[model samples]
Target: MTIFWTIVGIAIFFVGLLISIAWHELGHFATARWFGIKVPEFMVGFGRTIWSVKRGETEYGIKAIPLGGYVRMIGMLPPAPGKTLGRSRRTGPFQGLMDDARAQSRLDVLPEDADRQFWTRSPWKRIVVMFAGPFMNLILAVGLFAVLLMGVGQATDGTRIRDVSECVVPASVAATQEVEQCPVDAPPTPAAGAGLLPGDRVVSFAGRAIEEAQGQQLREAIRVASGPTPIVVDRDGVRVTTSVNIIDNEVQDFQDSTRTVTAGFIGVSLLPDYVRQGPGTVATEIGSMIVRTGEAITKIPERVPAVFGAAFLGEEREPDSPVGVVGVSRIGGEILAQENVPWQQDVSLFLGLLAAVNISLFLLNLLPIPPLDGGQIVPAIWESIKRNTARALGRPDPGPVDAARLLPVAYVFVLVFLGFSLILAIADIVNPVPFFG
Candidate 1:
């Protein structure tokens, strides 16, 4: 059963990923068309085409590898200065690469495409076109998070008894054991002594209404109570009054599991329920994820050694370590296969994980390093600044930024990215994140 669900979960993630990639490309395709740039291809994934359809002038298709996708736009790179397309006389170290890039960029350019070139668009419009893809990812992430946090709510302890312990166990023992129970010589806990049972809706602790109590949590009420305490619970649709001696015992601290604090024990576990959160909570969580993801990006190079160790030397993988697409899909499988987990909770977790992935994609594509949307953005911004400077100095329009000159850098970027992808794939299969999820 676990194996079945694991496979199902991985399939779900893979499908979801392809949809995300398609949606990302849609952003670029739509904006480019809005500005009259010729788009020849709108592809999801890479490698050989699995399916395709020609609509209008665009060839929309799915490819074999589900890693990434692209939209082939006409004139993504302007022609070499003082040279026609496909006719540049290469003269320098990187000029051959530039010429090739310019030639490739011109393949979709027809005689009528002179005014429809991507490089001919206003710098601000070009910026928008480049920015749109990642913006879609961000929007999708926010919508997913909103659904999980605000619509579906979050798992939190509620004012109801899920279980009642038969006997009291020391906090240190309870922390280490899979299940805590009484030995033959152990005495019954106060809750058990008072006959508290599962399915009881806790109404009040002492004289305070349970709903009005601090955070509506019974633990805090029990922790501060001493001697005999009155408890009210809604049982079988009727209020049932009871009393128990709130015994002081060492328990795991709420804020930190590593420390123990002396607190009152009643021997009952609160039932967990979905508690709806406000938009503010969603904003805070999104903000935190952004910061964390940004920090992780900065640390990728530093973490490669650790990834290598885990892959080759049987070292343990850190919980917060980097993971590739394969690793993440595997994690989705593990999450669905978790035992004794509610289906709703599982779906929420899976969606949250997907949202985090989207956030990573959003940030990764925004990196100002050619070939990437962010890299394209850099040159557009530079051209914008340059044209503004030229106009102020009464100089001639310098024309479009020759993005082809960046082909050498783009080649290096692709090589490095592919190399990292290879390492990540090896590590994912050999030493995937130890998902004790």
Candidate 2:
């Protein structure tokens, strides 16, 4: 049953992936047509076409391999200066490459398409056509985040007490071994002695209001104080006040998960709550995610070797490390197959995962390197500036920037990306990151 659900989850992700790809391509397709550019095909994959339909001037299709998709706009790579369009010679370096590209680019370009070619458009229009794909992903990402935050609610670190411990013991040591309870010599925990009970919501601690203080701030206040301290708890809709002596004890550090520290112990467990968020909170979270993703992108080169080692050498994989599409799909499936949690929780997690993936796609495609959206955007903006400056200086109209020369660079970029993609795929299968952990 678990295996069946896992497979179902994987299938669900692929369907979502296909939708995202189509949405992205639709952005480019729609905008290109709006700007009068000749679009030959709008494909949602990279291999042989398994299904296709001709609609007007464009062929819409689904291909065999579902790794990625593309929007085929005629004259994306303009013809050589003073050279006939799609007429490539069998001489010079990259001549064959240019020939094949020019041939495919203008597959059905008619004589009337001379003005309809993408190169005939002004630089701003071309920039919009190239940037529209990633921008669509960004829009989707924001919408997904808004849904996840407002609809599913956010898991918050509130001041609700889930449980109370009777005796004092180091949580680190307790985790390592199965000790039934604290030893006879152990003292009563502060919360237990102070009559703290399960389901008691902390109203305040050390004269600080929980409404203003949150559970973490109250925790820090408790950890820093000693002697008699006043705490108010809301039990069964009634506010109750109590006093307890905070004592120094060895326990797991709340701030740093991996370390143990000696701090004031209260012996009560915090229960996280799911709270609704407003638009401002959603915006803030989106900004934070963008920053984190940007930092992760910067560290991707450094993390590849670790993934490679984990895949082949049986090395431990860090949960925070980079994950590929396969890893995300596997994790999504595992989330669905989880037996202990509610199905709603699985849906929330999957939505969050999809949101994150869209965010990544948005930023990655914006990278100012060849073959990516930002690559062409940069050249288009530069060409616009050059042309504008030439006109302002009473000079002749500078021709469209010949971007066909970047074919070799784009090839190298694609090859390097393919290599990394292969490595990440293997790592995802061999030493996958644990979703629950």
Most accurate candidate by TM-score: 1
lDDT of 2: 0.84
Angstrom error of the Cα, residue 34, model 1: value is 0.4
lDDT of 1 by residue, 371-401 (tens): 8899999999999999999999999999888
Which digits, one per residue and each the tens of the lDDT, describe model 2 over residues 113-199? 878888889999989998899889888888988888887778767687877888888878776787686799988889999999988
TM-score of each: 0.87, 0.80
TM-score of 1: 0.87
In model 2, pairs of residues that clash are none
Candidate 2: where are CA atoms >4 Å away?
A: 1-4, 84-91, 158-170, 173-250, 262-270, 339-347
**Local lDDT at 176 for model 2:** 74
Q: Which pairs clash in the backbone of model 1?
A: none
